[model samples]
Target: MAKLFEPFTIKNITLKNRIVMSPMCMFAVEKEDGIVTPFHVTHYESRAIGGTGLVMVEATAIEPRGRIRPSDLGIWSDDHIEGLKTLTDRIHAHEAHAAIQLGHAGIKAQTNDIPIAPFSEEGTVTAMTPHMIDQMIDQFKVAAIRARKAGFDIIEIHAAHGYLLNQFLSPLTNKRSDAYGGTREHRYQVVKKVIDAVKAVFHGPLFVRISADEYHEAGNTAEDFIYFSQEMKAQGVDLIDVSTGGVVNVPINVFPGYQVAHAEMIKRGADIATGAVGLITEAAHAEEILNNQRADLIFIGRELLRHPYWPKVASEALNVELEAPTPYKRGWN
Candidate 1:
């Protein structure tokens, strides 16, 4: 059985270990033009230097209005290229594969501009027109091309967490009667276009993050994602990063490794590689997920935030020898 430190490979790219630094928004792009600052560069490189096998950067907006916050990294234009390249270069310098999550915040966008969604439940807002949908897909494609130019090893499409793609995915929000809504397959139209667009430019390993369970009885379940995951795989997604909740603003019962089962189900049901995320803080527990063949990778979120050195410490706990940066080697046991 593979351990937490075991490597995972797909489509010619290999992650040195199973530990992935899940994308977490820092809202540190103080420039306000969707450009990342030095904080973003250092933020990701620290985890790379700390021995994380893969450092997935925070959700980077594909359009000015798609930003989750006023201050968030973006790849909407060519001007954002150099800054992102600097980030990936630093992570690669530490031998960690770098990835970027491309996303659109939709109605949840924290901007002055009125947000858009499949169907607006709030005050007057634009329901994305067919032309707007095409533009959005193009934006994702262009962002992906820019990420490849920035030297990202992987590109993860953020289709989960009630984001734009998620809005189109869930029946709770997507009540449209057009070709882009209603039935499950119809609702998946936008995501399929986004994935196809990304694949056109990015031949590298691709991943899609999805909320396997919406926690609302009327919302999607893990079983529903089995087919969605397969659809993602067919569109060239190399892996499914399984996460749950955020489709609705409901309180969910949180527990350690609570979402591991979702990842397991998607992996077995969709016949695709999957990554487990959500309150998974323990190295032993992460190893158990891999050893049991439940998940190909474990994405650590808040734990990695509270302790950037968690990967190094986790390596020790697992009796795995992970090399530290030369300057930090003295801190190693």
Candidate 2:
């Protein structure tokens, strides 16, 4: 069997294959109400029906002010739970594990409210007070509760792409003099608290997406992420979904499998499983990564967007028999 088609298990969750549909925001909430819509239901359920092992919902905001855009999906309240549950039910009905990326955009939030971050930027963003920080941790805990109530099998913390948690992790943006700043461990305090808070109520396979390479001279390097990965492993995180370059936008040289090296480094350095993302579109490359023990899972982003039935394409390319959904079996292969 192709490694890409092999089952992977972490904690109590088992993925039928290594292909993970990377979380990409659709920005399709037409009413700005932060509720799941028909478009989202169709968008994600199509990938599950296409044979994706794990269908990750987009970066869902934990609070309205934390959204990256006005239309991003949300899990901040109990009202959001019903719509999300409907979506998860569809994915699970297709035999795919459902996961949600809980995130807060912080200073990068595009909402009308004053954005919050680790440090205050003059007239730009507000520094979170200690009480606010405590509240933020509780918000993540509450979001996890909603995810469980929504019937999601996994929850991924979005700490990458220069979002709220990434703001606290990267020194380029986190310029604080308090305990949540200065040293690497200090900078990690907020993320650590967030992880602990989520793990308190979430027992499923917990994943964290991190910007392993900050793309700046003073930013967190591969070595720094090795430390972060170790800390997350110790805290019972099941996987580190490795993706790079979002903390501060610098031009990145794009290529196929460019970020796979970072995932491999973290896997070896911290001895933790990781999901390799960033331009990984080919099945052979994904198999090679897993076959060689470089990374445990392959996260396909744009390609999956372009081709919802990407796993079938991968199975054909890898010479594996991919069983299509019952109704489409005669037309498939």
Candidate 3:
């Protein structure tokens, strides 16, 4: 059997295949209230029906101000749970494990009020106060509870792409002189607390997405990520969803599987499972990564959007028979 189609288990959840529909913001919430809409239900369910092993909901904001956009999905209020539950039910009904990316956009958040970050950027962003830091950690904890109530199989903390958490992890963005800054361990203080808080309430497999490379001379280096990965492994994080860039906005040279090396490094350095992402659109490349023990999972992003039935396409390319949904079996065969 092709490695791409092989079942992989993490904790109690077993993915029928290694293909993860990486979290990408849909910005489809029309009301700007941070609630999931019918579009979200249909969007995620389609990928599930298309044979994705894990359908991860987009980067969902933990609070209103945390939203990357006004229309981003929110988990701050209890009212958001019902809609999220409905969406997860549909994905599970299609035999795909449902996951949600819990995130806070921070200085990257597009809102009327000032955005928050690890350090103040004068007119650009507001530095987080100690009280605000405590509040943010609680927000992550509360968001994890809502994810459980929403019936998600896995909860991924979005610390990548220069979002709130990534802001703390990167030196280019975080210049705080307090305990949350200075040393690498100090820079990791907030992320560590967030992980601990979430794990206290969440018992299932937990994942953290991190920008392994910031694409700048002074940004966090590979060694820095290795250390961070080891810390996360010690904190009971099940998987490190490895990604790169978006930390300092420097230009990145994109190519197929460009970020896979970081995933492989973290896996080997930290001795933990990792999911490889970024421009991995081909089945053979994904198989090579898994077969060679470079990464544990393949996270498909833009390609999944271009081809919802990408798993089926990959199965065929890898010469494996993927069972389609009952109604589509005849045509799929």
What local lDDT does model 1 show for residue 131?
Answer: 92
Give per-model TM-scores. 0.97, 0.99, 0.99
Q: What is the C-alpha RMSD of each candidate to the true structure, in Å?
A: 1.2, 0.8, 0.8
Off by over 4 Å in 1: none
lDDT of 1: 0.90
Residue 24 displacement (Å), model 3? 0.3
lDDT (tens digit, per residue) of candidate 2 on 31-105 = 888999999999999999999999999999999999999999988889999999999999999999999999999
Clashing pairs in 2: none
Please write out the lDDT profile of model 3 over residues 98-131, one tens digit for every residue.
9999999999999886899999858777889989
Please report how far candidate 2 places residue 37 from its true position, in Å.
Answer: 0.5
Q: Please give, for residues 132-187, the per-residue lDDT of candidate 1 as tens digits.
A: 99999999999999999999999999999999999999988899999999888898
**Collision count for each candidate, in order:** 0, 0, 0
Name the weakest run of 10 consecutive residues (lDDT summed) in model 3.
118-127
Model 1 root-mean-square deviation: 1.2
Ranked candidates, highest lDDT first: 3, 2, 1
